[model samples]
Target: MFLKSYTGADDARIYHNEGDCVVRYVKEQCNRHPTNWPVEPGTIVAAYAAHTRQTLYLEQKDFCNKNHPLGLGKPGKQPQRSVILPMLTPNNRVLAIMEFDKDETGFKEEKIHYALAYGSWVTAALIRKGIRESLRDAKEYNATILNCLKCFLHEKLTLNQCISAIMITMREFIRAEKVIFYHIIADKKLDADIYEATSYNRDIFTKVSRKIDLRKDFLMKDVAENHVVVNIHKGDEEQDFKKYNITDPAINSVLCVPIGNPKRLLGIVKVINKVDHPMFFDIDLVNVSNAGMYCTSIIFYTAIGKQLDNTITIANKQKVTLTRHMIPCIHDIIQFRSRPITKPPPYYLSFDWYPTKDELSRDLLADYVWWMFNDLFEGDVFMEKFDVFVLMCKKGYRKTSSYHNFEHAFCATHCMFVIVRTCSQKFSYLEQMALMCAMLCHDIDHPGNTNPFLKASEHPLSKLYKFAFLENHHSNVTRILINHCKIFDHLAPDDYKAMVDDMHRLIVATDLAKHFRKKKYLDDLVKDKRFDDSLPAHKMHLKSIIMTTCDLSGQFKPFDRTREITFSLYIELYKEGDWLKSKGLPVHSTLDRTRYLDIPQDQVNFLSMVVIPCVQLLVQMVPVLKDPYTLSCNNLDIWKRVSFSKLFH
Candidate 1:
């Protein structure tokens, strides 16, 4: 309620809050005058509010007459009524005193109550605004950390380099002058070895003494032992600075956040003197404090190793294969007739030409990816990360499939690359990265069987994922493989999470069960020019659509690749059909091996139904992608001829 704010220790009613923050008096009525909200404590409006603890009303005369000195009165206009409201917090603390300067009349009881009701909503909005602002700040803080990591630590990482990058990143993250990383050596001393970042986001400044010998300083050691973060400014808890004379006074404000987990103190990151303010803010405190956690996670990871396992140990009924599924090491880097991808080659021919069982090159795949994304990941990081990623893709995919192997993955990946290259102008670097990675591992660990075969056979994985069994497994396992090796350790947590999550959705969208639904969704989007590239949701939806066409793209390949894969599909389906008969289950007519001639007819049917419609939809979206549609038409023509020949024979 609008009570008379005390002028002194006494209960004297006065309107003297002109210089306050929460409550104040202003000469002008505008939004910027938070420090000077106008006061009318002695008026009838305030008295009525105090008496009722509700909205108070005053007639034009009562508001503008001698009783209210704060009322604004024009020379010729008639005085209007005033509605004084008490804006309160949930705890009933008066946050602000609100007043409608002019109203039609004070006699309308319903209008007064309506304004009072809106005041309650305003209270909730203010509270929620604080919460939203806090969350926005947190997101921005995290983004800073991620940006630093993405920029600095992408390639050829050494311990010193990682530490230096982190030190500089933490410094820039909080806009501090100097960021020092203290290495806790044998619980004795925190040697300040890592470097610093100056203004303009440069890492040039350094201290003469690279070590903080904690054995000599008791006060500094106490702070180290307690594992506490101390942020000290001139008047703000200056005693926090008094306990430790570790930094220079010219530095002014100092924030020391200890880096470690619950187990042990790994190090302490000390940032002295923020650039903008003489004293650090709460946001600065939060950023540096969080930097400790990120530092610990990195230290823990670095301490362990980045040596990626070339194999996944799969335990089965027979035995535990210590290195069951393995991707062979790159004996040599593929010498691509490496040309710049100014535009996509008609249909991924440069990558998948004259494909053979023994001629597949992991290095070739890695090199093409490195080249394609080199713009985004320049320097050594692109080569380093994609080298590991390519191997991980190979290791994750099963060798059981004649088709759907890493070679097919490579082919499919190149299709996605073509799609991305065609549509690259619209996507962000991260979006491109997510889309590329999604294509690379779309069919990881395939059992060389259809989803129905797996479900009917009651394969463990089918029961596990249940719905999009194989597709979900591919998504989960690929993620596990990348995470296990810590492939994207160079990326910030937020970026890594975004890439991983986006890639997962793309991979899951490859499930044929979700295909028609996703296809229709895109078809609808195209029908109404609803494909807004500016919207993230539309971009992601488009990524899903792109992934679906790319996943089944083996059918749209040129004659040689198409023929080889069609025969391989028969081999896989026949294998499933054989397995189904062995289990005494009635095989579906389409999957029955006895109808071998139907493979071409099925190809024709599939082209006429699933494959052609989706590719046509994609062609509608990206008209430059006419090659795949042409290839689909050509494959349909050949498949029809082959089906007719088989029927006659």
Candidate 2:
């Protein structure tokens, strides 16, 4: 835990570079000790004394009064003495408290005042550390803002998008409820009115495309003509809006920052209503004003059909950083929500729990993941971690992919679920968990390109993870998201690590490179009669085969669904092939869009080659799971009649 102190300016609050050991020690001891001590009151009092230039010295006897009774809530060891000395600034305000707490120790009452000298040194050291951290944070934040600004420096965005981007940047920096950018259309004389405005009011942006009376808006006029920023608060907005005869609800605060070259103003950036803080300061003005300059460049370059320079000079590279909430869960993306697969479907052996075509949404898949996990572990008290894990899975398979998307993940999950049911809960809890998670996160963040294309083109992802091709890279990204989100915080350390390893193994096994090796082993295991479900290694081999089968589950669905899946896969492959060929790289024969093969024949080859063999191995291990194997055979028979010109008919 950390507490911030305002050591630089009145509004500039900064925290020390290191954690407050006092809080950590006190809190940890509170949890570990048998003493039912209240920590909050003492911590607050320490901070208060640190802020108000006071010191507190409490002995065990002092706490033996009616409030504490020998400093024991339920008869536990009590601290002999506690000391909190104010670390004060030169102006006599407390910067912080330097506390020393001891159990079964006597304090030198005469030399206790000597601790006052340590308070000054501690205050100075903490303030210095805070300054260094504040500087580093400011540097990093500036670099990030610069990179975010480059996103707006493009010609592809419509004028409205550009305008919205400008206001968004301003509002984020200033923490304002509203931000408006008004373009100053200049006459030949360079005189202009603040017209063509776009405003982000509260949540959504409303395009206010109208000419405003410049004489009535003196703040904008002052900013445009004098090229100076304006900040007004404390009920000043009421009079300004009244002066313009505008009957809208009045804002509490307003800032007008000029945009464009210093010599000539091209636009005005107006921000209003600081949400997090009470008032807008110089820092907010400076940040919004700097961002407005980039907005000007975007507006000018875009209007002329010329690309604005997006080159960033910062050391930090820009990335699409998403928060835990921003990471799209099933709830975030889906239009409808329903829970159809309420209980285990009838005939868990056949496992024909199919949803209507209209019920296909990311929400259903997310809900299904939760429902299945709940069913598998009936006695589990809560599943907040598992719920977040599913959400992260939905988000990990972003919209960039066509075939390797969340829907594909859901299909794979459905197949795995069916197989699990067929096996009659033969798998352990951890094994089932591994299989389900692996199916959901197998193709996360796929780039629509093949391993061969990635390796040939010298992609950074391939180089970073050289062993397992794209599978390892996918596994890498999945782990990164998982660790960043920290969804499995409830698991024990060893259990968490084991589960992560299992998930990684399952995902990496999806690569075809591991398929034949695992298959050869599985073949030998079956031949030697050494395939024991009780053994972890044998279970892993079974899981590998199951993973392979589930990944190719698209080919085992009904004819319409199989055809749809196959077309989507081919489309993605062709797109990759087009990119590879355009880059003057050799393309795989199957993915070559121009050199087209018989469409259904290609799928027939995939099912006959990959799906049939995988399903054969799976059903051989678990004889009851022959339904999916049969379905794959039926789909292959349907695809045998498909031709390129009239495949659907």
Candidate 3:
């Protein structure tokens, strides 16, 4: 529809077009130009052909003969003769026309250049539009995948189910042939046992299940170590297939993607072959792999939940037995200590309540107290020296109502045991009895509640005893119980004071706020190797630390048992925190509500960080504590794996 125009001093013609085939017409103009320049016609034509190919959508070969044709073919199958031509494209199919006059030189050359430039502009515009469309499509696809993953997370599906669901979505989206999941196990093995092989290839899956050791397989090892997706197209058989034993003829291509856990190698997802068309897998593989990893994590967490539930059941049974026997002994000791002040013996201590007359006897109380002492202390030296201390408390009680009952009696017994264990052979009978009596009465008439209750009641004990000197009040109670109680009328003066000091140190350590300070002191003493001494002071400190250690040793109990006890303790602490908050009081930092429930994740992490270390430290300090330490450690490790396994939903 357009014509070429000529403008030059030399005799040359030009051809051009206004249609889509402008570049082809430009070639015709070049061919018609005079070939008398310094450059050879063939060279100029080749250069023009290359330029046209780069700037326009025209084929390089078709453009070659525009200016000058290179005869490129066999003799019999001769190529077309050289000529410049206008092209027609009325029906979207180009028709070549190699007609042009021989004398259109300089003007033809200018027209050829103009046509080439116009064609280039059109091609560039089309390319830019194509790139924009591709970007939009990619963004939409990514949004879809992210939305799907969020849904899976919200649903809380197990890792396997999540992976399978994701694979189905991805497979349908991508139209892939098969998606195979492979998990990496400890010892660097691939576990194909827990896999989702989608594509309706039941027969192939059966074969794979029977023969694959996923863990030991070479392909899994490579995926885990590299932590990347490996794409293999057909004919790229350079990999040592013999080593992997992957002779399956059906596998023409592979996309092996590593599913990485934040902490370790979770597994791999191998998408095998492409449907509809043969295309090489690329970075899109990572999208599928990430989905698989999410699934694996869900499965792992589920397993841990089951294990914890079982452990809690076992722990509850143990707690019932412990509470029944231990609480009664504790109750009796409390009653014995309060006997001196009440004068009539507390209602709980009367014949109607206890019913047994022997329940209040010194010998029976002494024997029962000694048995508990042995259970806790685990030695014989304290039992033999107990009688001398009992007599001193009896002697001291005649002067006052302080050391009369079993509460002071037990406290005195505990102190005497501490001194006896520490002083061993050097312990004096009178000193042991006085100390025992003082320890027994230290908490006599004790209100069941601790500091928070004291503050709330505005009790006389709370006012007389400021928080800073609360330990002094305990000392005062011990002195009063021993001096005033008629039951301890048999104690010597010097023995009583020493007993008060030992008992004072032990009871005051029960304050949880002082836990860190006590730990620091014990750590320092242990570092100094102070256990080698038999001094009463060192012995008393050791006994105090041991008692504190037991008090805080709830976490080290068997996993099941500890959970039940800890949950109960957690609830109790939570209630206390609530009360303190209501009263506008500052609760302890550790009693924050966020930490009270022992959530599974927190519990597992605590076992790894706090519980294990504490138990190990106890065993290191006292080798005899090894059984509980080892048991707890083993259980924790098992639970961790179980938790991980269950999470792989």
* Model number with the top lDDT: 2
Provide the lowest-lDDT 10-residue window in model 2: 4-13
> What's each prediction's TM-score?
0.46, 0.48, 0.37
Residue 46: error of model 1 in Å?
Answer: 74
lDDT (Cα, tens digit) per residue for candidate 2, span 1-649: 1111211111111111111211212225447321122222342434334333457677656644443333322124545666656665554534444545455444555445555564467778867876698578657656765655565554455555655655665576557877776766654113443322334334444455555645456666566667777676645356655553445455667778777766766777788777633357676777777766666666676655432234232211222353343365566434223324444344432433454465564246667666766666656533545655677777777677789888888788878877776675788777777787778789987877778778877887777786677788677767766776675556789988988999999999998877976777787778788889788788788888888888888887767777778888888889888887888888766688876655777778888888888888888888887877899899888878766666656
Question: Which order, best to worst by lDDT?
Answer: 2, 1, 3
Determine which window of 10 residues in candidate 1 has minimal summed lDDT.
4-13
Deviating ranges (above 4 Å) for candidate 2: 1-326, 329-354, 361-363, 378-382, 595-597
RMSD of each: 21.3, 25.7, 23.8
Model 3: lDDT equals: 0.47
CA displacement after TM-score superposition, residue 560 of candidate 2 (Å): 0.9
Q: Cα deviation of 484 in candidate 1 (Å)?
A: 3.1
Q: Deviation in angstroms for 295 in model 1?
A: 45
How many angstroms is residue 383 displaced in model 3 relative to the true structure, after the best TM-score fit?
31
* Per-prediction backbone clash count: 5, 0, 79
lDDT of 3 by residue, 390-421 (tens): 43333323222222234333433433353344
C-alpha lDDT of all candidate models, in order: 0.63, 0.64, 0.47
lDDT of 3 at 292: 69
